[model samples]
Every structure is written in structure tokens, then in C-alpha cells.
Target: MEPIIHGILLAFGLILPLGVQNIFVFTQGVTQSNFIKALPAAITAAICDTLLIVLAILGLSLIVLQFDWLRIILVVAGILFLVYMGKVIWTSPAANNKETVALSMKKQILFALSVSLLNPHALLDTIGVIGTSAVKYSRQDQLLFTYACIVVSWFWFFGLATFGAVLKKVTIPQGVFLLFNKSSAVFIWGTAIYLLIGLWQGAY
Candidate 1:
């Protein structure tokens, strides 16, 4: 029970922040025509999170943190991906347009993968925090803790998507969603720049 509680709280603390993964999933929910259409992004994100959590607990975190070259590569790739994602988001059509085509299933899965796996900060957090936390547990306790975190991740993303869909039903102005796209793009770009600076400073 302790492990379960700790896992839930830690996972929530990490995931509750507004990051690229969350934004993309929520926007898909808003832009897609229906809940089913929005699910690919959510599911992809969940699966990625599950993979990360399992790997972290199994000691991949320690392996990742050891090599400076590997860390640099991850940060570089993350920055490039964020730049491309920002451009894509900025040019996206208004959510309220009847003809606004949401991301295709393949694109959704790809985008979800990039946002989930490319972010070095998120990777470090999972590896550093969750990985370290798991060190205190063993066998069945470790499995329980890992499962708790994974479950929270799945539920949170689905809920985020659901909330976006609900908000879409509210008849907000088209321009508002357009502005959201633009703003989200700017935020993503800013994050990329921030990461680049960190890398330049050898913070990664």
C-alpha cells in the first residue's frame, strides 16, 4: 500500500505539469471530430509512459544517465523534434472549422512517440525520481509500485483527452482555438530553446 500510494503521488506530480505531451493530446481531443478519433494520441502517450516506467524501474535510468554522449544526443534530438512540432502546431487549422482535419492515426502515433520519448527532462525525471524510488522496494512491491504509476499515466491522459472533447462541445469561438494553437506552438518553441541552452551549458 505504501508503494502504491507513493507511486501514485509521484506520477501525478510529474504528469500534472503542462508539457508538450499533454498539450498535443488535449489538442487532439479538441480538434478531432469525436472521442474515438482522439483516442490514438491518448493511447500512444499512455503506452509510451508505460514503457518508460517499466524501463526506469528495471534500471534503464541508471544506464542512460551514465553516458554524456547519449545524453547530448537525446537533448539534440529533442530540440530538433520540438522545433518541427512547433511549426506543425502553429500552422494547424482552426479547431472549429468543419473541414479542419485532425491528425491522422499514423501522425498521432508518431507525434505522441516524439513528445513522449524525445523530452530529456521527462526521461530524466522518470529515471531519476521513479527509478530511485523503486530502489527501496523489491520483487512484488516494486511491481506494484510500477503498475500504480502506469495506471495513473493511462488514466490521466485519457481524462485529459476527455476534458478537451468536453470543452470542444462548448461552442467556443474559432479564433480562440486558433490562438491556442499559436500559443501552444510558441510555448513548444520556447521549451526547445530552453533545452538547447541547457545543453550548451552542459546541464544535460
Candidate 2:
């Protein structure tokens, strides 16, 4: 129970922040034709998180993060991906949810993968925070902790997407959603810039 509670709290704290990954998932839900159509993003993101959590607990990710050059490569790739994603979102037609061409399943999965695996911050958080925290637990407790985190991640993303889908049903003006897209793009770009700064400062 201690492990479960700790895992839930930690996972929620990490995920509650408004990040590029969350934005993309929510945007997909709002812009897609229906809730079901948007699920690829949520599902893919959940799977990615699950993989990361498992690897982190096993200390596999720690090895990758140990090399300075490898970390640099990851940050560089993440910056480029975030920049490109921001542009894509900024240009998407957000004026009408029904009229907009939602991202295909392929694109959704690809983007979800990029945002999940490419983002250095997320990787570091998983490996640094969760990985270190797991060290204090016994083997059985570690398994419980991992399960708790994975479950929270899956539920949070699905719930977030569902919330966005519900918002689509409201009578909000199209301009509002368009504004949201623009804002989301800008936020994503800001995150890219932040990562670039961190890289420059050797914060990665």
C-alpha cells in the first residue's frame, strides 16, 4: 500500500503539468471526428509511458542516460521534433472540429512515440525520479509501485482525451478552439526552446 500510494502521487505530480505530450493528446481529442478516433494517441502515449516505467525500474534507461554524448543526441532530436510538431499544430485547421482532417492513426502513433521517447525531460524524470525512488523498495513492492504508476498514466491520458472530446460537444465558438491550437503550438515551441537552453547549459 505504501508503494502504491507513493507511485500514484508521484505519477500524478509528474503528469499533471501541461506539457507537449499532454497537449497533443488533448488536441487530437478535440479535433478528431469522434472520441474513438482520438484514442490512438492516448493508447500510444500510455504504451510509451508503460515501457519507460518498466525500463526505468529495471535500470536499463539509466545506462543510456549515463553518456553525455547520448544525452546530447536525445536533446537535439527532441528539440527538432518539438519544433516540427509545433509547426504542424499551428497550421492545422482548427476552425471546425467536424470539418478538420484529424491525424491518421499512423501519424498519431508516430507523434505519440516522438513526444514520449524523444523528450529528454520525460526520460530524465522517469529514470532519475522514478528509478531512484524504486531503489528503496523490495522486489515485490517495486512491482506494485510500477503497476500503480502505469495504471495512473493510462487512466489520466484516457480521461484527459475524454475531457477534450466532451468539450467538442459544447457550444463553444470555433474561434476558441482555433485560439487553443495557436496557444498550444506556441507552448510547444516554448518547450523546445527551453530544452535548447537546458542543452546549452548542460542541464541535460
Per-residue alpha-carbon lDDT of model 2 for 1-204, expressed as tens digits? 988986876676556554678778877888888899999999999999999999987873355446657656656765676677568667866544342347999999999999999998689657755664555456788899899989999998998789778886455566765676677577656656766776778665
Global local distance difference test of model 1 = 0.75
Root mean square deviation (Cα) for candidate 2: 9.0
**What lDDT score is found at residue 75 in candidate 2?**
60
Indicate the residue-level lDDT of 85 in model 2. Answer: 59
Candidate 2 regions off by >4 Å?
60-101, 169-204
lDDT for every model?
Answer: 0.75, 0.75
Residue-wise C-alpha lDDT for candidate 1, range 1-204, written one tens digit per residue:
977976776676566555678878888888898889999999999999999888887874355456667656656765676677668768877664232348999999999999999988578667755665565455788888899999999998999889878887455566865776677677666656766776778665
TM-score of 2: 0.64
Worst 10-residue stretch by lDDT in candidate 2? 92-101
